[model samples]
Target: MIVVTTPTGDIGHQLVEKLLESGASVRVIVRDPSRLSDSIRNRVEIVSGSHADANVVNQAFEGADAVFWLVPADSKADSVTAAYVDFSKPAAQALKACGVKRVVSVSALGRTTPLANQAGYVTASLAMDDLIAATGVNFRALTMPSFMDNTLMQAAVIKAQGTFFSPIDGDLKLPSCATRDIAAVATRLLLDESWTGQEEVAVLGPENISFNDMADIMSDVLGRPIRFQQIPLDAYKARFLQFGYSEAMAHGMTDMADAKNRGLDLGVERSADNTTPTSFRQWCETTLRPAILD
Candidate 1:
């Protein structure tokens, strides 16, 4: 049996679907089963509660052959480090106690880069990989750069005003990934237990794409003149804060944006195995276009 955390999240939901199709006996730890579709609920064993809860992880990991772990961001968190590293402590302990053989987790790139220690959110996430690895479980950290799917958050602006915004410079090229691509690699790792020890699998998308390039692709795919706007870091933090993010988290986000703008996410090189199949234009056509249309 494989235990999956955040089964209803963008990546987790897709992972669950693929695992079920492979006829794996899947189990999920979810805060609310009601959010899951009837088909998923009926198919996987449901352990109802947050994975951060020790009791929940202890119960969910029992007899599990492999597990998928992800520390979903909590905007209301008191501190940035607590959100990733602290949230994963229970599951780390459970993995040791349960004797699970493999763990595939969603993580970011820049493991040994200088920014890994300074960038608040990335620092915490890299620390999370360390905590999990200390348990001696065979781990594969699906490290990725900025997600192409993040543009969906600005879909409304794209549809209404033909513009999207970010703190990164519009001309600076950076690596990107689709959640679908990440899920594809993750599901494959979870199913095949042959690989051992800990490793970071870079899941960079097909190419490096700038926000300006993305706007051009969106314009072509959506048949409209879409543009990229570079908002100030303070403005970006204010927007997230307006949505109820804590002061610490909002600042952390701004720090991460600054680091990315400075080429922090470009530390990883795009290669055959690491570069996933989805191209920016392909994702814009399939995912971005539909979100804007809807």
Candidate 2:
């Protein structure tokens, strides 16, 4: 049986669907099994608990042939980096102890970049990837650029204000991939079991596209003109603070945006053979428009 972590998330949900379609007996690690739909909860064997506990993860890893791993973005913690790695260490240890063979992890792009240590989420993600590798499991660390689905976070803003705001430079064609596409690739790799060892799989869309280009696409998808607003770092930090982020977490976003603006977030490492198809326009037209328009 394949064990999936964070199965309720967008990509995780799709991965679970694909695994079920493949007729695999699926096991899932979830904090609360009752929160899942009865359809999912009934079909899959649920090990209800967080991965933070050694015993919890060890039980979840039992008889799990392969595993899907992801560190959810937790900004509420006092030290976000420590919280992620501390939770990850036990899972890694459990996989080693249990002899779980293959692991597919969800991680951010630009992990090896110099400023990643100061870039908040990227830094923590890089550290998590390293910790997972230490287990000597045949691991695939799926490093993807900014997600196309992130636009959904701006759907309300685009509707109400007719604009999307960010500190990223408008001119830089930062790469992006849909979460579904990423999940599809991970599912394929997990099911096939062809590739092995600790490796970084960089996923990029057909081509790089800028934030302004994205806004233009949003205009067509939304059936109205939508502007791209570059909010100042101070203003962005203030906005994040208003959303209840700790000062450190709010400023962490600011630091990441500054790195993205400087093009440091664009780590151009990619794999050619496993290329999955989906352009930003296709993602917007097919996946995004339906959700926003609905």
**TM-scores of the candidates in the order shown:** 0.98, 0.94
Error in Å for residue 41 of model 2? 2.1
Task: Provide the overall lDDT of each model, using Cα atoms, as 2-decimal numbers.
Answer: 0.91, 0.82
Per-residue lDDT tens digits of candidate 1, residues 1-294? 999999999999999999999999999999999999999999999999999999999999999999999998799999888999899999999999999999999988887578877777877888999999999999999888989888888888889899999999999988999999999999999999799989999999988889999888888889989999999999999999999999999998888888888878888777799989899899988898888786
Q: How close is candidate 1 to the true structure, as a TM-score?
A: 0.98
Query: Which residue window of length 10 is worst by lDDT in model 1?
Result: 111-120
- Ten residues in sequence with the least summed lDDT for candidate 2: 267-276
Error of 2 at 265 (Å): 3.5
Please write out the lDDT profile of model 2 over residues 72-149, one tens digit for every residue: 666666665765777698898999999998999998777667777777666777888889888889999888778888
Cα TM-score of candidate 2: 0.94
